[model samples]
Target: MHPLNDIFVQSAAIFLELATSEFMRYILAAAGLHLLLSTLLKPLVRRRKIRPAWPPKGQVRREILASIRSVLVFSMLSLGAVWAVKAGWTQVYREADAHGWFYFGISVLVLIVGHDTWFYWVHRLLHDKRLYQGWHHLHHRSFNPTPFTAFAFNTGEAFLHGLFTPLLILVLPVSYLALFVFSVHMIVRNTVGHCGVELFPATRGGRPLLGWLTTVTHHDLHHASPGWNYGLYFTFWDRLMKTEHPDYLKHFSAAVRAEPMKRAKPVALSIAIAASVFCAAVLSGSGRAEATETAALETISGRWVTEGYGAVVRLQPCDKAPMELCGRLDWIWDPASGSYLGMEMLSGFRLQGAEWRDGEITIPGKNQVFRSTIKVLDHNTLKVRGCALVVCRKQTWRRLESLPHIGLR
Candidate 1:
């Protein structure tokens, strides 16, 4: 094949892979979370009998089709990314240590702020009378948005929005890990914005330092009435441009204050007890070797203190991918530290032979991942070893029954 033809072929291949991967990521993160939250809060929705109903009929199907198209557009943008990186047109660095940790940290902050600005302006442009019908109407169709609405942009809008990362890399030197983190943050915030529930605490949304941040109510209102709140990831632009809805706080308060199911607490408690009993019975009835293996598996599934005591992570079975184990950061020891709670620290682990292998462990603050292995050492201790190339480090973590309170008296 001709050289240019070869590039096209490669880009096409890249597009397909990226499209499939992005679709899975979006669906799993958005739809899975939507299902979990909707199911868990079904009783609350029922009791409150809110208007516009949870997930209007035919809305999910339309959202899915629109999202599929958007993912394709995003994949085309990814093709541009691949070509740019190959042609030496981008400043994306592979080594996290290339510019040191300080530069890496600053670059991530810059990337986020830059993207927020870009999104705000582009979003406002999409809402223009001339462009709204052609470019953004598909997304606005979801008058009562759900998490699936997060990626349900028209092809033109998706292409425009997806250009941010590719363009950012052309001008700014960012570590690959930083780019990955930014992408994850974008999806999570986007999903939460369209989740149709106000997950933020009622008080936090009213505080001076935090009140400026946008919430679900802020974005949902924009979906309900499309002339304002065009910012993404933050409220800086909306507040500065005076586009924020006046009654945002009031709507948020009412949404959060809606009555929860009276029986939810007792139902949750009963389920927890039943699960505990089932697990205990299975372990107690097994033979010696079988019981030991079961105990090890159970031991691995709980709160654990990380090696450096920097964070506490909970290891649990991934509900979407049941064959694999996942670990998420639950808390950090340093209250002043940057927020990393709820981020996945370990993922894709599967048991092979006597040990849990084929997993990747992310070292928070370091922006690095290592091929990792976990071995249950008795019932209280776990041996975790991570290797980068040939250099390897092993850490012993103790299982914690619960997180420790670290605040000052």
Candidate 2:
């Protein structure tokens, strides 16, 4: 046997061992937390459920399967750290006292804070319209995520997240203990954040320390509305960016209070309750009620002629997701394009304030879709924007009712 071959074989074995160890650690942490919170302690955790509704069937299974792939990607990347350590390339040290007790402790804290900073920026990057479908969509698939959804990342996302440890070790000196603690803390908080349960009580208004850190509700709201709450361990970055959801505190308070049938309030009492709520809102000088009313009243459901009046699309409540809007091609100016009629042109348009967001719109003559948002400009006009990657284009859609001469197209 050749000497080079012997080195290669040994290196491969070490990589495999490291990969297996990392994979099992993830499985144990994710599954153990799921069983503990979602099954064994359901009665308790259910009281602080962030969202009253449960995830749809098969969601958990899908999450776990997708997570397995992510674990492999993570494991493979971790091997790079091991190799770096052997090559004397990274600051990773094994001895506890090598860095002194004080430095050891500080290193652990630094890793936590550094990882948080890394996560905030990387997460925001993943949400770029060009990268979302390829990198972030898998994680967001679990709108009502569970513990199993913690590492359910797309391959691109897994690679980016997995790169953290290797890159960190290369620049920052850390002990093995610090790395272990960081890994454990990261996965635990991640699973809990996705568990769809708020484990912390509401903090006092403007409370210090506790108010600054993120709770389960913070990350869960990110899953519910991806445009906000991009921070991982703390609210500092999101708040600094002015990207934290405005209703975050209100949602946190509601989750902790555990109002029974919160999302399913009886219709009989709705009007009376709504009246009282409206009065309280007005007295408090809050404009949220008016915004809600506007969202509900501005129906974008109707046939509209696309820009250039080249096509007509019918917007309606999606059959598969009744709460969201879907659009289908109703007609096109070109008679030969009849085959495109009845084809879905837009989907997954959820109401967010006065705009419909996080939707996909198909581009003509292409087999792809891009991120889209629609806003009602008036009773007869709509503002439609589509984005592919970093570039965005806008279009104005006029109601089909305004076009009286359809026969002369």
Candidate 3:
């Protein structure tokens, strides 16, 4: 046998011992946490309880029946686990003096993760039409779910569930403790999928810190919309195969939006202040760019500058004046590549009105294009505003007095 098979043969034994040990507490905590989230988020995360193919029942008879089916399936599964043990496999841990608690925990986690990876793919396949009418559809019979609705699948569906772990043990050497942890992880993630409503944060794209952690909301959506949301834990498989529903991201967005912005007010103020200062500087006269006929107001024309180089901006009224106006910006700077990254952004604004206006400014040199608009506050100062995205921002430029007076004729 390969090193991995040997370890799994070993893991099969350890799994039974830990299952009998304090491992139950870890399982309980994971279950409790998911339950708490589901209960709390029910009202906020719920859909309209629209039963499409199936109608609602008074009591959870269907759910109970499903749970019974699941229990039967697992009872059969124990045979596989037990068989490995009877073959003199578990004797290593039973008789061996010991490696202590740390080794034990690691093994349990592997077992659980291996189980999940297996279940995710197999459960996904069992949803096919041929398989569904026979096995998977039994669970779908109760469209509107309750906690007990979990595990309410036909016996055939249960085999698909067991297929993943057995195949997993054949590939790599996973620890027994890790398997248990993974099992607990799978159980909680599993229960939440059938959870009538989702409570945990439904991450879009994935968790920012721990990318790709699935939430109960995704599974709930699947129950609500069969033929979609096949992935049990992560949306990766669903996304890759395009089995995920159309509005999946929308659901995730709502969860992300619900997050309270603790620093929103302060952040807004800081942005506003930075904008105000930059505006004051721009309008105060800095550099001047070449003249363009697009200028809305001839009076707004002048030199806009930063702390260093100056960009000359000129506006000549064009196309019958009052209605149509065009503008242009040219950046004049000491061409030194190193100056760009130096704290004082040596490359933020080069075009005068282009920096502030909500219009397009073309950079023919680099194949880059941008838009900006400017609002003059005084002869010496003005506000320039523009954006690359939906988020708009402002920067100020001061009118430079030191430059030679090159007024429009």
Candidate 4:
């Protein structure tokens, strides 16, 4: 594992261990709020005498099969998770005691990607022309689905869709608790999306406002058009795959149809930004300033290398100010980092338009990278140098004029 990463994981584990009490209390508080919402708010909907029509009987078979497939796949995924943990897949996950956090994260990420792959395939299959006429067409019967409609699927379609995660786990190694959390989050999100209840977008207690679940309008539209809005939890797949309804905006309720789903706000923002940039460029005479390539970035323009406990740095254009104007280091090898620690040198430093102007000299090292400058110091010699901290050292060059013309050209 990377040293910085290792330290970060260890620190997080310690923090969690130390704050277990606070963590539990926070969990308890969340649970309490959920309980209150279920007992109070949900019942209000029932008392309001609102009920939605269930999907056709044919659609019912899909949900039943989906649930079964979901269970089977999860059991297999458990085995995969165990195997990954035992394998010590990476240095990050090698130290089991210290790296459980990353291990868990890895497992969940694998599960999600796996699920997406499978869901995409299965969903595509369900939409296939041949299958839609027979096995998959029934689910599309609903014109406006309520909460009950979310699970409305053909048995075969549901099985294919829901089996993704478990099948993925068969090939992966995931933490059991992590899997559990992932499952719960997925189910809750799916169900709440289908719940058909528009929530207050304002913050309840300075937290996410209506972010806990997909809005009622989001799912209700799906039910209205079976081929569209098939995704659960997130909207990415539907939009990305072009499976979303074409008239979703036109038919959308005013409450939910605020400006045609906005087309993922960022697109407009990006275009606006681009247009603004273009206009700015036009205003500023094409926004292109005449530039001469005299150096790389200032931070990287100098020399660099990693040595023992401490490093050595040298600065050039050697003014009285003792910082890394430029310099170079000898050479070193970092066995752990698997990187070469080498020296660098440079000269003729000055502020160039938006960048530092200077010449660079580099000395490549084994298992390490190096850099420097070539100013054609003299015809008989060349400047050689390296750096550890800042500029390590600098010496006037005395070689065959320019380069073998090998890399220098």
Report lDDT (CA) for all predictions.
Answer: 0.72, 0.75, 0.48, 0.42
Model 2, span 244-350: residue lDDT tens: 99998888877766344433233214423433432332223223433553455346778899889888899887766656788999888787778888999998776
Model 1 ranges off by over 4 Å = 1-5, 39-52, 204-209, 258-409
lDDT of 3 by residue, 239-305 (tens): 7778777876666555444334563344335434433443333322212222332342455554455
In candidate 4, which residue ranges exceed 4 Å CA deviation? 1-39, 42-98, 141-152, 199-216, 246-409
TM-score of each: 0.61, 0.61, 0.46, 0.39
Say which prediction, candidate 3 or candidate 4, comes out ahead on TM-score: 3
Model 2 misses residue 394 by how many Å? 71
**Model 1 TM-score (2 dp):** 0.61
State the lDDT of candidate 1 residue by residue for 294-381, as single tens digits.
Answer: 5555657988887767677889876555446789988777765547778889996766446776578987667678777788886767
- State which candidate, 1 or 4, has the greater TM-score: 1
lDDT of 4 by residue, 23-134 (tens): 2322232233234335544543332211245345654345434433444443344334333433544121222224467767777766665565565557667777988866
Error of 3 at 123 (Å): 2.7
| lDDT, residue 24, candidate 2 | 63
